[model samples]
Target chain A: MSIKLEHLNYIYSQGTAYEKQALRDVCLELRDGEFVGLIGHTGSGKSTLIQHLNGLVRATSGALYVDGKNIYDSSYNMKGLRAKVGLVFQYPEYQLFEVNVLKDVCFGPKNQGLTDEEAEERAKKALAQVGIDENCYEQSPFDLSGGQKRRAAIAGVLAMEPEVLVLDEPTAGLDPRGRLEILGLISRLHRERRITVVLVSHSMEDVAEYVERIIVMNKGSVMLDGTPKEVFAHDKELEQVGLAVPQVTYLMRGLSELGIPVRRDVTTVEEAREEIRRLLKRRETCGQAAEGQ
Target chain B: MLRDITLGQYYPADSVIHKLDPRLKLIGTMVFLVSLFLSHDWIGYLAATVFLAGVIRASRVPFRYMLKGLKAIILILLITVVFNLFVVPGDVIWEFWVLRVTRQGLSQAGFMAVRLIYLIIGSSVMTLTTTPNDLTDGLERVLGPLRMVKVPVHEIAMIMSIALRFIPILLEETDKIMKAQTARGADFESGNLIQKAKSMVPLLVPLFISAFRRANDLALAMEARCYRGGAGRTKMKPLLYEKRDYAGYAVLAVYLAAMIAIRIMR
Candidate 1:
């Protein structure tokens, strides 16, 4: 297993009047090189769970083992673990603070104890990988566009060369174009770099298009974990938890209800396009065969 | 994890104290605070303690929460006790290098600690019972006379209330920034003092940026809603005193009288 959580429970402000049970006995094991999409409504413990993977938030009652080491154990070096599992927080642009874009991206590699040359090299490669222009490197990170700033922030984490990358709502609060740019960059990074990615998002379409495995969270527990095709099949149950499958999935299901022989498991536009094309070709062949008869 | 701060935080509940007029509650708290320092003997402290306990029980806020406020002040309490112990010259009981513990110092230290405790608890009870909104309203009303001196009392109260409301939001933002930095291998705990201070640069820079953004958004929102100033602005729920407020004042008067009587008898 790459990351393991056993009966993880986290209660915010425990024993106080404002005590809130944010996570409740969550047990999950993520294997190596798995692209997992964690989907949930607000306050469903999705952020809290990803924080545990990198040891940012400790499990209140249970054990979390990252790469075969119990993170909460006293002897375990959490700093090394943090470097091993990079987390890009929500609105990551807000976390970009260095004077220049290049320097900001170098923060992670430098913090990981890399020498100046090596850190600079890693930062440059990560920035290039995220498609930030070289001319923008010397400009202040605060001066970058929203999407560029977000990319720079991601590059900061990418520079750390983490084994597993966890991002929370990476495309939130962006325009359609900016959203596509950032998500495409992340998808490319996952595809080419083969980094294990855990994307915590509310956008079912984004999750459906990208991830192989989907974990549905509700009320601080994992309600469902399966392939996107399987998880999105429980449309009514997901709706009860204030969530839903992708719009394309709903469209395919609607087409089937209208007496079209379309597959309901279709999630992405490409998948729906292929299925509809196949259905039309089958009809054309059946009509030709009937005429031949 | 930073959200556990209950200091000066209002505890929502239905009780006699919660129902009293904010103006009366503010004035009562002031009187109680002043009366805490009026007594020099143990009898005075005892009377103050009894009055506070009675008010706390009436407020219906958990005593445990009130005491939790004391946790944040433990260092200040210790410093005051220690400073008072070593500085006050009197009948010396114990002496060391540059430090003297005297009978008067001991008694005075105890008095100071109790006075400080009573002060904190009294103010905490007031704040716990009254919300930031009501407190601002009460402050503006109580300081209305200062407007004649061109003090901008309403604006000041508005600023105070706004700052109070943003404290928790900023703290949560700060916690998020800290976690983001930590996830990037920023070491906040294991560093030396200087290293720790330097590490905070990452957290603070982001927090300040977000705070400014939030403030800008809030200002735009207020302006868009046509919020000009407090001039000629009337409260939606204007402050009004019911019979219970008068009764609360009468009880406060009796408590103050008991405190004065105890001081005089000693």
Candidate 2:
């Protein structure tokens, strides 16, 4: 279930005037059950790097291994690899083409050569996993609302039951509530399925809240790889690369600079609130000691 | 798979041919193709060849590219040449068991090959120099007079424009769908013919679905903007016959007349 890339380099439109070196030599790995957040500015090779995981875009020169199998090996089965590493593209709903929702969600499982009955069962379960009602199964996918379409598209991949789920900006273009719902669904899937989740996003706050580990990319290379707290500690360097620490982390750092005795590593509002409460209690005890003296 | 297609491919450059009015270039290509067919002898072919060479040089499109375009149709060109050489009865210059090579046959084959080559080179010059949008605009302007015969010239032009616009978008969509299926372990390459065709089902299903979706969206978008199809539609950039265009037409007319005169003389 783990994915590894060794010395990956990608050059787009190779040998053409439009040739762009999208990814430099980069090495990274994601183990099973780890929710890794990949953050980078636009054109920082974040998309190119993730696309390599499933062999969507083969590395111009490098090696990619999934579950101890060399993906680029001539003997490897690409279609099977794709089934194992399910990549939900950005705005995947655009890829939906079936007349109805059920058929569309069954597309992947059907391609995997499952019996029609088996595929239908998988599709139903997958639709449920993504929180889509069974009543909507017979309706046209096109008739669904934007958020529902997004969910159905995700369920289409989930139907394949991939061990490694790589999502590219899954929450993009959604309203605030829809964004939260999708993120919650993703977190639940990661927890219940124990799937390796690689979420590519630009929002530091979203990554900080959900992902246990963060890999920051800058200009086609890995800039930092650590826990959210460890990565956010280099706020200045992150800012230099057009990235920023989470707002809560920023606020904590600011309070620490003013001698507020708050920890600068807090990346969420709840943690910040608890830290402030603890500091206030300590201050009260110190004030009592001064009065007693 | 779709990305490999080079249709509407424009090589960006600052050459003189690139600066010429697209309408003029389109007409020039038609005139050049006609001359290639009208030429009856080596003298005529040589004259056309020199003229084509001049156009190619001015356009600044690499000669190798014109050759590449011809390479795509090499089989058809070869068939034409062979058919003319072997099938046409004439005074035999060389004879084999079932093969006869004659002076007239050789000449006809040579002329046909030259004509086919010139036709490809002439049109490729137009594509290489002009962008797809400008080429469609030029086509609409050139065919505007067909409206007198009740032909839907404007509508056809609009369709052409839309089709051209969708080419790149469809190509990009195809690339995305192919990659998606490939990620799912759909083997597109290294399979037997049946396997290959089977693999295409996933790619095609997604591609066709996206294409229809795009078309539906585009239609809705057009309707939202009150697009009423070619009726009383005003152009943002109206087509005007400039002095350069007239001069280009004059040159083409002279070339056509000269080719006709050569045919008659022959």
Candidate 3:
């Protein structure tokens, strides 16, 4: 129900001329049913860190524990660990390879030792959850539209019934509408299932609106970790590491600097709008009292 | 784990061999390979060995790095040596049930092993020193005469260079696809040989689709830029010969002559 990383360090091509320290002492704890957004620029070790959530990539030094069990141990069940942590990679649509969409979705559950009938049932349910119609189930996965193919790929992971779902830029390369659709689908999945969701994204606005907590990474280390409001409050530090606060937060800060006496920590447009309305109402009430006196 | 491949990898350096004209290097490699076959005795092999060593030293690429490329062909090297050791008939030096070792067999095996090792090293020296771009340009120029007979020399060179460029890219893509499937509980390991291959189907299909998609996009991009084959095409870094290239040819000529002399003496 929890994944904890302690002093994780990963080096690419260790002992070779091309050796690179990709992760440097990254420590994090993701508990059950927590919606966390991992934000970092390119090559900030976001992908590498998430791969360790499961047993896909081993850390050069450190302990990775899943549900209080040390997964880095030699005797750990890597297959079971993978099933517990379902990861959807960027442009996951390319991983779809079965003759039909339903079969592709069944690959994960089948690999987990499910019977064909059971796998099919799970796949069907997962597909429906992703909003893919039953009619598209028997069609070739390649024939689906880009968004549908991506959804089918996500279903392939969801069929495993994982306790933790880690998605790496799941909405990348999609149009604005497709982006919203994918994000909404992920938000709904997190709410209904209460699963630990680790969303790795580049879009500040999307991360601020969706996740309950935010973790900012810089050069393979955690730069900031807190709720959206707490993390966005360190706007200057975030910008120094090639990242920016959400657009709404910037607008709110600008209004505060202009002497509007509004909160500067608003992370979403809705919050900014409410703050402005409150400020205007207070001013109007004060003005009426002064005129009557 | 897929990054161990060193074959066809270029080693950048500021050395005479790296700066030599690509055409000269190409011809020099060809001559060296032909000389390896022409040599008939140990004396000839000794001369070839000395020449190869000198060229490798001058290339400035680490010897160990060059030998890494030979790891892929070690099995083939062993098979050839073993075949020569038992198959050649001559005065028997040792014998067993259905296995006999002869002086001629022993000599042949020794010669075969040396020739195979030297052949790989010779080619590796060329590829390691020259960039793929220069190699393709050299190939096109060397085969330019074939265009008179309508052989599409430029197109062939273009295909080769593109293939070389895509090797690393395709390796990266394969790694990503494998990880994606593994994250979904796809067991690539802990399976029998057939079962393991069956698991690769998920990896292969997506790879092929992406490769074709990339190729299609590249073709469209090229055509959009008004690509029209080899007809009157100009080069950005045209091939030019220098004093060092002349010196390289002279060295190649001397080696070939020595190899020919050894052949005639036998």
lDDT of 3 by residue, B1-266 (tens): 56555666787788999999889988998999889889868999999999999999998888987788778789998999889899999999999999998999988899988888888889889888988899999999998899899999999999988887787788889999999999887767777999999988999999999999999999999999999888889999899999989988998899999899999988
Candidate 1 per-residue C-alpha lDDT over B1-266 given as tens digits, one digit per residue, 9 for 90 to 100 = 45546655778888989888989989998999899889998888888888889999998888877776677788999999999999899999999888899999999999999988888788889888889899999999999999999999989999989987887688889888988998998878887899989988998898888889999999999999899888888879989889998898899889888888888878
lDDT of 1 by residue, A145-251 (tens): 98899999999999999889899999999999998898888888889888899999998988888898999999999999999999998999999999999999899
Where does the lowest 10-residue lDDT sum fall in candidate 2 chain B? B1-10
> Tens digits of per-residue lDDT for model 2 on A167-283?
999999999889988999999999999999999999997888899999999999899999998999899999999999999988888888998788888998889999999999999
TM-score of 3: 0.93
Q: What local lDDT score does residue A66 receive in model 2, on the 0 to 100 scale? A: 87
Candidate 1 deviant stretches above 4 angstroms? A287-293, B71-75
Q: Report per-prediction Cα RMSD to one decimal.
A: 2.0, 4.3, 2.3
Cα-based lDDT for every prediction? 0.90, 0.85, 0.91
**Fnat, one value per model:** 0.84, 0.48, 0.90
Q: lDDT tens digits, residues A134-216, model 3?
A: 99999999999999999999999999999999999999999999999999999999999889999999789889989999999
Which is the better candidate, 1 or 2, if ranked by DockQ?
Answer: 1
Give the TM-score of each candidate. 0.95, 0.82, 0.93
Q: Candidates ranked by lDDT, best first?
A: 3, 1, 2
Candidate 2 overall lDDT versus native: 0.85
Candidate 3's displacement at residue A271, Å, is: 1.3
